[model samples]
Target: MDDVTDRLAQLERDDEELVLDHFDRRDAWELGHRLAHVALERALPVVVDVRTPAGILFHASLPGATADNDEWVNRKSRTALRFEASTALLGTRAEHVGFDFFDQGWLDPADYTVAGGAVPVRVAGVGVVAVATVSGLTSADDHQLVVDALREIMAN
Candidate 1:
């Protein structure tokens, strides 16, 4: 398969896995720390956030992250939760459809955005109950950071 196709497939797998994985406050803390650790190791300046449908569980802003990054995180998280899909996937789909998400979908541009970095946090047989988000990198890179951290968290 082509690189783009392969990347999409991997993202699909990751979305499914992350959705099925069980999580609670403890898990949220662990996952958040793990994300931060990796970002620090890579020297990536970013903001990480984890939240349940009901409330936020964790949030952090690393070096170089800005208030604007926090706004993007909110927008991206809303997109993922509303659609029950990763923002990265949504971004890709929007590009394929010629950027019609706002006009065609009847969603307000101010409230929701299909940018990358936000992913639905779900549990097996429970469906999506939270959102995990990172911002400050390219869309693909931000999405991959969360996916990679979740993969590592689930493997252990």
Candidate 2:
């Protein structure tokens, strides 16, 4: 948890706008949908996951998002659990640790492509509590959509 916090803090320092105002499951879902729609509009597949106190609260797969992408979401969720970090961070950390979190096990068998496009949603100062991710596009583009969606959602 400290590691997660430190990383988030670093991100906040690097980009003050990265700080989130916090949100609940409903808001997360709405934001996730917005992100999914954006990815779909670009003809890129997207997958969204909203974690809640009761468990995962919502999931959506846009057109062109493959079954493998769904599986990668699951894997990312699991990895998030293991690391006590956001799925996005977990994927990044995995790469730093010399393992491609998105290319192992079921992910490799599927059309899973992991590079970017995952974000952790947090309730202000509470740390990461959910994740929104997209696939089927360049990792950079996927990540940009997630970031843009969050910015839009938070601005509203």
Best by TM-score: 1
lDDT of 1 by residue, 1-156 (tens): 666566677777776667545788998898889998888888899999998767789999999999999999988988899899998887776665467788875888888888789988788888988888999999989988988887787789
Q: Measured by TM-score, how close is model 2 to the native structure?
A: 0.66
lDDT of 2 by residue, 34-61 (tens): 8766766776666766664357776787
lDDT measured at residue 5 in model 2 versus the true structure, 0 to 100: 62
Model 2 ranges off by over 4 Å: 1-17, 84-115
**Looking at model 1, which ten-residue stretch has the lowest summed lDDT?**
91-100
- Please list all clashing residue pairs in model 2, or write none if there are none: 117-142, 117-143
- Number of backbone-clashing residue pairs for each candidate, in the order shown: 0, 2
Off by over 4 Å in 1: 1-6
Candidate 2, run of 10 with poorest lDDT? 106-115
TM per candidate = 0.90, 0.66
